[model samples]
Target: MEVDYNKISRQYDDVRSADLKLISLFSEEVEMNENTRILDFGCGTGNYADKLQKVTGAKIYGVDPSDGMREKAKAKNSNVVFYKGNDKNIPFDNNFFHFIYMTDVIHHIPEIRVMFNELKRVLKSNGKICIATQSHTQIEKRFYVKYFPTTAKVDKERYPDIEKIISSGKEENLEYINSVTYCDNQLVKVGKEFVNLVERKGYSMFHLIEDSEYKQGLRRLKSEIKEKELELETAGGTLVWFKKK
Candidate 1:
């Protein structure tokens, strides 16, 4: 969906802050220390950047095209540098970053090829670029796909393919080192929290479809859940990680 991120920056972090598992996985894969320079690409509110900085004592940098998002991130932590940059042009010197991590924001980027080149340009030799994103293979079987059918179409068209990432990695001399799948749905009370989340329209995917469709799907979900009157589980996504060859 075409988005005006400045309008959503305030509420964005509230919903996104649900999972820290991705951050843990990143710390495990990317070697971190006091002197390490880390980049939180497409950082929404700099929440992860702030968390990472504290966890590893690394000099952290976050980049996003949204001024509102950047400002929010900067407000969270002044120590971490926040930049306004895009997919084709990341305003950084060559071999600048020891590690880079982007999650859930890959599909939103408009320039995949140029961004891949930019990644290669700024990333240090042997530095890992960890990408946590949705894959086409997972979409057909996603639990929530039934709720909002159009989401599958939107996601399939936008999400970068694994093979393509590997191909780009090969062309960029980056390695297709490792990858994994994650079931990211948070368990919540079906009657309350679950419905509230849907109402908040926290996910950008919710904004992709028409309001009528969104309500239709939500109504169905709520009806089904009120029958159970218990907890609900949602969202399934996959993650892929690559390294500099």
Candidate 2:
């Protein structure tokens, strides 16, 4: 799936803030010291950077493949050294990071195993790696699949299961830390919110809907949200943290 970096860079904080609470909790779960070095994988616009820094006062390094995203992140946190990187390779040197964070980035990565291996390569002997990803069972996934089948196909193909993620880390010789799950669902205004999300992030690129299809899909979605009490849930990603043995 081709993500619109410019669009997502704009909505980076607003659309993704839901998981910040849980991610923050995961940050606390780690026993970080003052001098810890963190590699924030796919650190879009530095949302996690601020929280992680605030919580641990650790040096932050952000990696994103998108120039737009890296630019935004650099702008947000002047202290953060943002670099461009893709799924297959990270820009950092081997055994350089004390902690690696991959929050909500697994779905966007084209090659999962390569990224996992890269993380393992960069981590210190006892370094920790934390990853957050959307739940397999999510309302948005369900509804979006019904209207636009491509979204489902793309997501399933892109998002590896947490078990697979953990096992991949194990193959890299990292010990399993923990996987935490948290979810919150709340009724929200359907039409306005949906429009806002699309307008903000341009998820349109990911949509198979044409202008005509979008009109019909919007109507159908509105009706569904209205009838079923459409709820925006922060189906928190599985936070799998591991340490290199």
Candidate 3:
């Protein structure tokens, strides 16, 4: 699927990054020492790059296909190199990176196998690749099904199982050291703003939802929020981190 990079890029940080809980987990798992050469695959708007530079002293290169995202990242860090293209053909030599990362972008890619091999190719031996994506747990899928049914189907079909990723890495001669999964269990209210974003992004990705269904889902979500005196943040998805052996 060709993603509407323009639309998604405009609101990427506001609608998505604010509540991401996996940042800390990824930080813990991927230890970056000084002089670390990093490639942040699908580094939309450099959200993680901003933090990685501050915390790790790693020389970071961000790659994304979104023009809007590349512009924003360049504005933020004038010296940072932000490339525009799909991740599978990263414009770098083999064994050029000490670490690589792709956060919440695994499901968005149409070619997962190619990306896996490409990531392994560029990484130095004993380097690490940390990927944080949605979990394949019943509870995780169930929540999306109830709140955003149309989007749930898209995610279910696209997100590769963490185990599959680990195995693929091994096949490409990248040793898998460990995989850790986390789920944040908490109920937060869902408001109209979030619902609108859900509808826009979800509808664009999956055309299975009708206007009536979208309205009904919003109505139900709002009603539940009011009754529970809550905000629309629910249990967060799990983050799976794998290290290269």
Candidate 4:
């Protein structure tokens, strides 16, 4: 199931370009200050580190397992440290980070409790881990679900239920700050944006679908886009934060 991200890493930036505005949703919910030492766990392609650095002026560090991805992250911003690491085996010292956040990355982590243990180790007493992810319950809102059926199907299987996250937090004795689920503003785009986004093949869901199925989906998407402007309502995920006890 391990797709060669070394190849996928190359196109990662082109497709998942940093959206400060979108990232702002995370920032607003987390409410971090300039002095907060943030760890962007599972920082892929380093696209978000610099944008976050610009927004918060905090000492940010990005840790990822992929050297290919780490190299790109390092190249993105020197101020924001990027290195090879993961949740269970982070490179930095214990009680080192004030806040940790991951976007659209938790579903990929197989050992959730192992990660929670590591979070307990490094996160400061005042630190919090903020997770922005799509809950299985919200799958119906996924805008491309019809187009990318496998993506939705895979997500349902992969995405952890909200209760698991909350229960995991409790097991670790981390205080849950509550989880909020809200849909963001819809992306009203014409056909061109829709076509361009699909062509990028940056979405992980696209990787699951067969090539023939993907092509068929693209054709369907394009045809629909051409007929009229598409007001895409991408599914909104959940943000759950936990503070060290």
Candidate 5:
């Protein structure tokens, strides 16, 4: 199912926020300074872009296709500039950014090779691109998947494999840097909070599954929550890095 960002923009931030650990990882991988220019590719709601600018004092720019998402991001009262664009056609000039990062965004892009080529066009020589995504194993082990079996299948089909991402970057002359997997030790949501998130279809995967299946899954999830007072556990994913050749 296709997610309508404009429709969901109102409540997007309520369920999602900047993952500080992921931001820290990106900061460590890329050398950001006051003079550095950074682009948040497929930046939804500008959360990461705003946080990154404050953390590194860098010139941050955000590009996303959703007007609603861009509007929300622009309202943050930060120096980060928001633009309406996508991975296929970035509006910036050649060699414009020192670093580009996309958090959990690669799966939505249809053409990985084309994205790498466009990223290369905007990235300065040796500039880095960091992609934070779930590997197949991670997706299979998502906490929600136990209740919603279809989520794992949906995500597995939608998300590109890690090896495929690396090869696409290589084909576009983007050298592979390193890949790291992280498992957050923090509890993201618990009991009723998690149930409410699923009820509202806060996650895109919830929209993809069959309505009957979703309803059944929700019932099962609620039962588990009620019986066990379940606490939604950690979030884990892999961060793939590359550099423009």
Candidate 6:
């Protein structure tokens, strides 16, 4: 099931926030500076874009398809400009961006090839594109999957394989730079707090699951929390890098 960002835009930031460590990693990898022109592709709510601009003082632009999401992003009053656009039709000129980054967004794109081509069109020569996503192993290892098993199946179906992403980029003449996996040592919510987040459908997978399945999973989760202190593991994902040559 496709998650509706327009409907969830208001509450999207209630649970989701920019990960500082990830932003720092992105800054270092892209070598962003005041002169850098960065595009945050599929930048939902402009969380990372806003933070990155503050961290590196880069000239940043955020493009997303959802009007509501863009509205929420614009509310931030940051230097990063937000635009209503998508992979097929980016609202920018050729070779305009020095770097492009997408965070946990590739799975939402239907045409990976089209997105790569579009990225290549807007990215300057030797500019980099960074995709932050979870590998199949990482998806299976997600904390809530044990309770909501269907989420794992759904994610596996939606998210392209890591090698497939690389090959797709190569098809567009984008050179594969490298891939790295990182984990933030911070603990996710625990016990009742975690249950509250799940109940609120903090993750998109929660919205995809059937109502019956979600209820069942919630019951199981509640039972576990009652039995023992449930603490979610560290947050992590893989960063796949490609360069426009």
lDDT of each: 0.79, 0.69, 0.69, 0.80, 0.88, 0.89
State the local distance difference test value for candidate 4: 0.80
Question: RMSD (Cα, Å) of candidate 2?
Answer: 3.4
Which tens-of-lDDT digit does each residue in 77-191 have in candidate 5? 4698999898789999999999999997898999999999999999999899999998888888788887889899999998998998999988887899988888744566568
Listed per candidate, the RMSD to the true structure in angstroms reads 2.3, 3.4, 3.0, 2.0, 1.7, 1.7
Would you give me the overall lDDT of model 6? Answer: 0.89
**Cα misplacement distance, residue 157 of candidate 1 (Å):** 1.1
Q: How far is candidate 4 from the true structure (C-alpha RMSD, Å)?
A: 2.0
Task: Kindly list the per-residue Cα lDDT of model 6 for residues 1-245, writing each as its tens digit.
Answer: 67899988878888788878789888787788899999999999999998999888999999999999999999884688999889898999999999999998999999899999998999999999999998888888888787899999998999997998999999999999998888844576568777877878888888888999999999999998988887678547889999998
Clashes of each: 0, 1, 6, 0, 0, 0
Worst 10 residues of 5 by lDDT: 183-192
Identify the leading candidate in terms of lDDT.
6
lDDT of 3 at 79: 48
lDDT of 3 at 122: 82
lDDT of 2 by residue, 62-176 (tens): 8888887788777776877888887777877899998888777787766666777778888888888878776555524444456555565556666777778878877767798
Candidate 3 achieves a global lDDT of 0.69
User: Residue 226 of model 5: what lDDT?
Assistant: 86
Model 3 steric clash pairs? 188-231, 188-232, 188-233, 189-231, 189-232, 190-232
How does model 2 fare in lDDT? 0.69
